[model samples]
Target: MSSRRSGISEEEINELISKLQSLLPETRRRGSGRASASKLLKETCKYIQSLHQEVDDLSDRLSDLMSTMDNGSAQAEIVRSLLRSS
Candidate 1:
């Protein structure tokens, strides 16, 4: 039940690989052709990186929107004070 690669059983390795493959949508699309663990790991790294970038982009956009809204409210308050004095 031991594999030469790492003294781990084949079943254990296959179970781990299946878990990894399930995380990847592209791998599921390949249908019958299996991806090596190395490729799957690489794809996972890229997928994680893309998600990280997306989160950063969204956060920046949200901050920008909040800043704009704050400024707009301040301007409105300034105009109200001016109208009251006149």
Candidate 2:
């Protein structure tokens, strides 16, 4: 194949292979070194947990404002009315 591609003789291919081998060490098979599904899932779960906590915190703050509205404060009711209309 090499002989036809570069017009080199079969003898040249053998010589080239030997020369390359002499100059470089033999290559070894590599390990996968890939992340496991559990590792990925744990990271994803952590990210989702942070987002969920943020949403919960925001909901709690909104709930506090909503609770204040029930006390019949005129300014709070106005804000609540505006929020409902929007």
Candidate 3:
């Protein structure tokens, strides 16, 4: 898939992998057993997909909030104009 504004950067992916490695048991960290390449790739893809969804959701929410604030401000201005006329 093409990279988007919400896409994870290499640095972020590396950080995530580092954190995951830290959480692994000492034996696993020492390479007694390792996750398969396919499994790791699948997990990473899932994580990135989740991040994209979260970013999109937050963006939509922020847009809605801004629209609400703008409407409120417009209404307040109308009310102030009416009070001045009275």
List clash counts for every candidate, in order: 0, 0, 0
Assess every candidate by TM-score: 0.64, 0.37, 0.45
Clashes of 2: 0
Summarize candidate 1's per-residue lDDT along 1-86 as a digit string, tens digits.
34866788888888898888887778888875778889888999998899999999987985675566655597656755765796
Instruction: Rank the models by TM-score, top first.
Output: 1, 3, 2
Show the lowest summed lDDT stretch of 10 residues, model 2. Answer: 23-32
TM-score of 3: 0.45
What residue runs in model 1 are displaced by over 4 Å at the alpha carbon?
1-8, 71-86
Name model 2 segments beyond 4 Å from true. Answer: 1-36, 70-86
- For model 3, state the Cα shift of residue 81 in Å: 28
- CA shift of 48, model 3, Å: 0.3
Give a tens-digit lDDT track for model 3, residues 3-27.
Answer: 2466988678666665664454442
Task: Determine the backbone clash count of candidate 1.
Answer: 0
